[model samples]
Target: MTTYTLNVVIDNKQLLLLKENCYTLCIAKKVRDQLGDKYNVVWKGTADFTQNNQFKWAEQYEVFALKSFKIGALVEAASKKEPIGHKQECIFNDSGVMEHAKADPNLGDDTFKVTNQYGATSFGISTILNGEHNTSYISPVIIKGHVVFAPVNDIRVWFALKLPTGTMFSDFTGEYVELQFGGDKTTVTVCYDDLGSWKLKDSNPGVVG
Candidate 1:
């Protein structure tokens, strides 16, 4: 069985996400600061991977997983070890949301790697996590790039920006008809904005709705 781990941030803290073995709809929302800053804020009421993870309860007032981790400690721990999540195309951005990535099949599994470490990108997050040799879901992606991933049946996607300084916002993971990506010489984009819109995570996480 292939196991996957996802990372998310809440209240300036980091946490890893995992599929639930129990609990149907009851969700968890922690007070990030009081929780010791070293926990994963996993939403208990998250929609199935096939559905849009977004819900409308009051826009910006919806509750979700609020795990918190000490940034300094996490970085230090990772540095002391081989790195917690350098394998599998799954990567966590500034929002602490995980995005599934893929490289060309012809390039081989070890071809794609995250940011260069020690002047070299660590090889094999995809290969290590995805030991499943049964099937493949290779879409038209490039340069060992990223693509928004949902459970095989989940159409769930983040709609609007979560928040400027927070983990979630009014816009939650919502449904869509299709998701696509493209790149040429200048830009490689997720085209999720066609469904809604968002700001560059590197440029700004966004403040207003």
Candidate 2:
């Protein structure tokens, strides 16, 4: 038998309201009713390793189960750039609706550590409340080293860049391609005076369209 917990966050105010047995989806919807529709609900729980008395905690996993709620109180407060009901929102680059959220200390989930400690990151907010483990080290601490942001897996996405007319190319993502005199697709080297359409480079293996 698997047990579950319902987690909700109202801007910065977080609540793990469900205590009794209930459908996880139903609990998520309830929080959504009171909070609007912007907040995310992250579910955390333990898994049964065996039918015996022993269980597993080492193989723990954090799943993004559901996201259904909004804290109107929090959002309204953030626009003024102030703490809203014990939560603070920090927006970077002076843009992006997505803001980094910090929970109020008074709420008492040990999230207060983030407020006092600078240069350290919060390990896991939900993990702290669940009592699954201790020591809140949110973000990885960097100590004087070359930081590399390498993708764990190959990513496929569209790339659109303006190129100068007659510009020569060398290599990209370990692949190489050269542009021709020009037909339809925009040339790699030269920027066109007129609006040009984009097409896949010929050297791109297995990419046709």
Candidate 3:
């Protein structure tokens, strides 16, 4: 079982700490409700290894659930003004596009093939979070490197990403994309735009949607 160390923060300062290693989604939600809308609850933990854990390499993953429109603002501010001159392939499902087309009649046919887009030149917010490197470091210090940002009340937008060649597991039942890196240990980074519309599996705790 995977557990997390939970912390409550307000104004960039930690207000409460729960380091019992027993924090889960249910416990976090209860704490969030009790804290109301003024605080931020964050957790740091490791994900359970897959049944086929053949490779014994260490990996790091981080999830950030920010307040309303915070993710957009951050992305916009961090995005490069000019392209980086190279594109990376990204695999995404057509569900989000189809949903948009359904909402707007002017979008035309909702039935269309989704193709991988290799047009991402800039790292955007990733540069700010991971520093000069575009990916996370391997076997980073837990307290300093691995961190989580839980939602404050109704905030739904989330940012979940992993380092290159690092596997990420999420229970987000929504439209998402993957950026895979193949090597001795294959791994991929999962991306989700909005969690409000996605349905999370209630059976599992700490599962993002």
Tens digits of per-residue lDDT, candidate 1, 1-209, equal 22222221121111112223321221212211111211121222232322212221110111111122222111111221122221233343345333344343433322232322122111111112112211011111121333222112111223221211112212223331211111221211122232233223232122222
Q: What is candidate 1's local distance difference test score?
A: 0.22
TM-score of each: 0.17, 0.17, 0.15
**TM-score for candidate 3:** 0.15
On lDDT, the leading prediction is 1
Ranking by TM-score: 2, 1, 3
Per-residue lDDT tens digits of candidate 3, residues 1-209? 11222221111111111112221211111111112322111121122222111111121222111112221122222122221111111122222111111122222221111121222122110111112211111111112211121122121222233211112222232322211122331322222113212232222223333
Total backbone collisions, model 3: 0
Model 2: runs farther than 4 Å from truth?
A: 1-42, 49-87, 94-127, 132-209
For each candidate, the alpha-carbon lDDT, in order, equals 0.22, 0.19, 0.19
- The stretch of ten residues in a row with the least summed lDDT in candidate 1 is 57-66
